[model samples]
Target: MNPETIRRRRWYILGVLTFSLLVVVLDNTILNVALKTIADPQEGLGATQSQLEWAINSYTLVFAGLLFTFGVIGDRLGRKRVLVAGMVMFGLASLLSAYSQSPAQLIGARALMGLGGAAIMPQTLSIITNVFEPQERGRAIGIWSGAVGLAIGIGPITGGLLLAHFWWGSVFLINVPVIVVGAVLIALLVPESRNPDPGRLDPVGVLLSIVGLVTLSYGIIQGGERGAWLEPGVLGPIAAGLAVLALFARHEARSDHPAFDVRLFRDPRLSAAVAAIALCFFAAAGMFFFAGFYLQSVRGLSAFQSGAMLLPFAVAQILFSTRSAAMVHRFGAKAVCATGLLLVAAALASYPVLGIGTGTPLWVLGAVFFVQGAGMANVMPPATESVMSALPREKAGAGSALNNTARQVAVAMGVAVLGSVLASIYRGELAERLAALPPGARTVAAESIEGAHAVAERLGAAGQGLIGPANAAFTEAMRTAAGAAAVIAFLGALVVLKWMPGRTAHREPERAERAERAERGTGREKARGRRAASRERTRV
Candidate 1:
């Protein structure tokens, strides 16, 4: 497409990009509400807890593993081509998942969906960077980021509504129509862009990255499932993954045509922005993981109610994200990010207080969600803009990949670490109560709050005693996890305050204006001298 034509349709193109992103983001949150139904043997797939975990982990592993590789490929190939192909693959995988007869089938289909998602994600951000002017990029990105918040809030509610009327497959089936429409709009409105000087492929770096990320993600997922990290299954893979990633970094630094440019980290803007994103997501993802259990298991709310409670969060995102660019313009990225992280810390800190008892008002929890969402809305746009601005437009795909990779890795680590903390604390608190039960029952009940509830149901009258202790133990675990998350968020605030640049609006533009004035003055002086010389020659 021509430049003017692309400019004229940029807003429409952005809408299409956001719609495409919704399919990927919406699927994960929607699946959360379907887990219980999917676990039912008669109603849905008779998947065990381990199988269910794999259904999620399989997708996460594949998505995180191939994200950067696909980003590089998008830069070399055409972004529009990759994006359309991804949407098609994702739609087909959704169909397969909807018709899946077994947990294994669903897991396999989800992996294919992940492959498609990896292709889709980086292209959206890169395309936005290419299409929007620098001055408008932040505003555009804020809208893009808000779409994520919208998806999070709506996914469970959508799943609940679908499941109420139809089968478990309805959740997956819902993605098809959206994907089809988005694909068509993308073809019509979105312009194709690629790096004109995309260098040769780095197959070796690509292999190392996939191996390292998949192994690391597996280790993290395994650690969360096992609720321990010291064992060989967890530690061995983590160690191997780290070593391979180190090698990948070394190779990329030396390669003539690197798959990912390691030297980008040298720019403080890029590095700090990446750290802010990683840390923010790390804390947020862990909190969200546990919040579901709290709302449903502890508070006795249904899936639909829990989903409705998140509307405050969604509202906050919609209200604040679109205006964050103005905040950044006034206060600067460093101020906005640090203040936002502080708000996130404050919200996380409230979790321990609000989660003290099952009787705690739901409104209080909703208020906390609002604060957290608002904080996140302020942080993402500025950080993302900073990351994109640090690199030339041609390298936007790589930059987008780096931003997303950091988030994905941090999410894995957060879930693993915080989940481990929750499990340990819960088991310790419930140990005495569990010991009174039969050996197998005690083991199962000690595994998780849900497992405890299952055991209690089986024991009937005798198991009624387990419910109170289980709820108390789980609440205590949640408090501890929230506290830890609060600390991480506070640390993120400190990191941004120290490293992110301060108040560039007043200084950089002023300097440019001064330079322009000086050049104009010099031009005028030269013109006067030329006129004087011409007059003197004519008089002679």
Candidate 2:
């Protein structure tokens, strides 16, 4: 497409991109509400807890693993081509997931969806970077970030509604229509773009990165699932993954045609922004994981009700994210990001105050969610702009991949680390109470709040006594985890404040104006010299 056409239809193109992104992100969270249903022996597939975890982790591992590879592929081939192909793959995968005969089939299908998601994600951001001018990119990115928040907030609610009306598979099936519509709009409106000078393929680098990231993600997921980081099952893969990643970095640094340039991280703008994204997500994802349990198990709210309660968060995200560009324009990225992180920290810190009781008003939790959402709204757009701006437009795919990979890795780490903390604290608090129960019941009661609740229901009168202590222990654990997350978010704020550039939005115009003035002054001086030379010639 021509530049004029692209400019004219840019907003439309953004809409299509956001729609496509919504499905991918929505899928990430949508499965949460369906996990209970999918575990039922009669109503759905009888998936074990471990199988359910794999249903989620399989997707995550594949998505994180392939992101960089697909990003490089998009740059080398064509972004539009890759995007359409990914959407098609995602649609087919969703269909397969919906119709899967068993848990194993669903896991495999979800992995295929991840493969498509990786292909779709980087291309969207790169295309936006290429389409919008520097002046408008921040606003575009803010909107894109808002869509992500929207998807996350709605995913569970959508899943709950689908499961209520249809089946557990309906959550996966819902993506098909949306993908079809997106594919049509994408074909019609989105233009193809690629690197003019994409370097030669680095097969070794790609292979190393895939192995490193997948192994690392597997280790993290295993740690979370088992709640044991030091076990050989967890520690071994993590160590090996780190070693492989180190080798990958070394190879990239040495390669003549590196797939991902390790050198790009030298820029503080890119590096600091990437750090901020990773840290904030690390903090937030943990909070989200525990909050779901708190809402459902502790408070006795249904999945649909819990999902509805989070609407405030989505509202706050949409409102602030759309306006964050203006905030950045005024206060600058550094101020905005630091302030945002501070808000997130404050929100996280407030969780403990809600306490362990059902008496704690739900509205207070909603308010905290709103604040957290607003804080995140302010952070993402500025950080994303910084990442994209640090790279040449043609390298936007790599930059996008880097930003996303940091987030995915951090999310996995957050869930693992905070989950372990929660488990340890809860087990300690409830150990004496659990010992009073039968051996089989003791193990079940000690596992998780949900498990304790299930055992309570089964015991009838005997289980009634177990409920209060389980609630208390889980609440205490949640509070401690939230406090830890707050500290992490505060650290992110400090990092942004120290390293990210301040007030560059204002300074950039001043620098440009000064350059223009200098050019004009030079032109006038030459004009005067030419006039004087002409006068001298006439005199002669």
Candidate 3:
């Protein structure tokens, strides 16, 4: 086959893979708006704070726990087969989630969906690696990465629109058509690909990793709400989780066919790109997660309203992301990424100051996110392109998995770390501010922020007087949390600037060469056609 033919086929494959990933990415943000509606049908199913936590965390736990194992399985079985099977599982789980009778059932179904997601996400990039020649892979990855931002942008709007018009179950139900369409297209279009030197799956490694991640996540989630950091309930799981993770690392080093690829970190560009993924996820996840609460609880926006409020971030991400490849080509990795990080930090830092009054203009909030979104658009695509393009072609499965694993770990940790920061400040501020009030009022104010209505019920008439102080205290806590988030964002930026290479090395350089050749080929084709037409006229 001609080079041009091969290039066209590769792009077609990329489309199928992108569709597969869209399911996983959409799931991540779709639940944000539906949480209240899902938990509170018929005036609410009496869902508790813990249940709400599990609703979100359950999906992440299973997804993160199984990612490495599934990656290896994809390498062993074939990415195409694994991707199909995963889509089926995801569809089934979504149906079950819609029918969940209680919070437990919903959480359980969501976990199942996560398992399916783990199967789906890694294969998209791996398939891109399989199909695209090295030179074109960066551009392909740029489009793939942009699709993620697109899914997120669409998720909130879709979720809100559905939830407002239909039921909470509508969110999960919406996935059905998408899955069916993707499955049909992939079945017809995508080809099978797998690892050349496939190895045995390590069950021990999977067990240890899952246990550790779950325990650590549990501690973080609970610590934020219940002050479990000071108690055995929080510390025990966290400590145990770390111990298990340590054991897994040691075991991987000793194993002949380890599930996790410890060797991928040996490459400087790959390592830097992975770290950037972690940081990108950490800041992005934290900002979005808390931004939900800030809109609803503090700003008094409803689910639909909050979803609408996130438009600036979503719009900017979609609009700017398509141009990321050109920007990377122009500015280089270090300059573009550093600029993105700084913008993100500035936006996060502005959150606290803006939280000061009830009259905070919606336009100002939107403007901050618009800038933040544009910065993020610059950072993610190049970083992802760099990482996937650096790996040897055969190692695509493992490399893609590792890239995603860093993102998942960062996402889980963000909820724990940044969520705890916000929760701790809120609890402390509330305690101090409410101290002089009546004992009952103080107790009412101390209930979980998730259950703030309970506190209002307890306060009775006295609640009116305390509202001003409580509002002031909550504003102060939000400001403090945003300040901390700013530091974290800045640190993430510094890491990107200091570590990620200004130029692509190894596979990346080769890919660039190929793109130049392809461009030359197109020019030659045009010139040949012009000469042939002129000669034909002379002959006539």
Q: lDDT by residue for model 2 over 1-540, one digit each (tens)? A: 899999999999999999999999898777876776676656778675456656776776677667777888898899999999999999999999999989999999998998999899999999999999877888899999889888878887887678778978889999999999999999999999998876577889878877887677667656655656789999999899899999999999999877667788899988889999999988987767666667877888776777777788889888999998899888888999899999999999997755534557888888988999899888888898888877888888889888887777677667656766787778788888888999998876666777788789889997899899899898898899999999999999999988898896435744665788899999999999999999999999
User: Which pairs clash (backbone N, Cα, C closer than 3 Å) in model 2?
Assistant: none
lDDT string for model 1 (1-540, tens) is 899999999999999999999999899878877776786667888665456656765676567666777887888889999999999999999999999999999999998998888899999999999999776788898899889877877887888788878999999999999999999999889999998877677889878977887677667656655667799998999999899999999999999877677788898878888899889888887677667667877788776777677788788889988998888888888999888889988998886856566778888888898999888888888888788877888888888888877776676567656766787788888989988999998877776777788789889998999999999998898888888998998999998988888877323643565788899999999999999999999999
The candidate maximizing TM-score is: 1
Q: How well does each candidate superpose onto the true structure, as a TM-score? A: 0.90, 0.89, 0.88
Ranked candidates (lDDT, high to low): 2, 1, 3
How does model 3 score by TM-score? 0.88
lDDT of each: 0.83, 0.84, 0.75
Identify the runs in model 2 with alpha carbons over 4 angstroms from their true place: 39-53, 101-103, 217-230, 353-357, 509-540
Best candidate, lDDT-wise?
2
Regarding lDDT, does 2 or 3 come out ahead?
2
Candidate 3 shows a clash count of: 1
List ranges where model 1 is wrong by over 4 Å: 40-53, 221-224, 505-540
Clash pairs of candidate 3?
A: 135-511
Q: In order, how many clashes per candidate?
A: 0, 0, 1
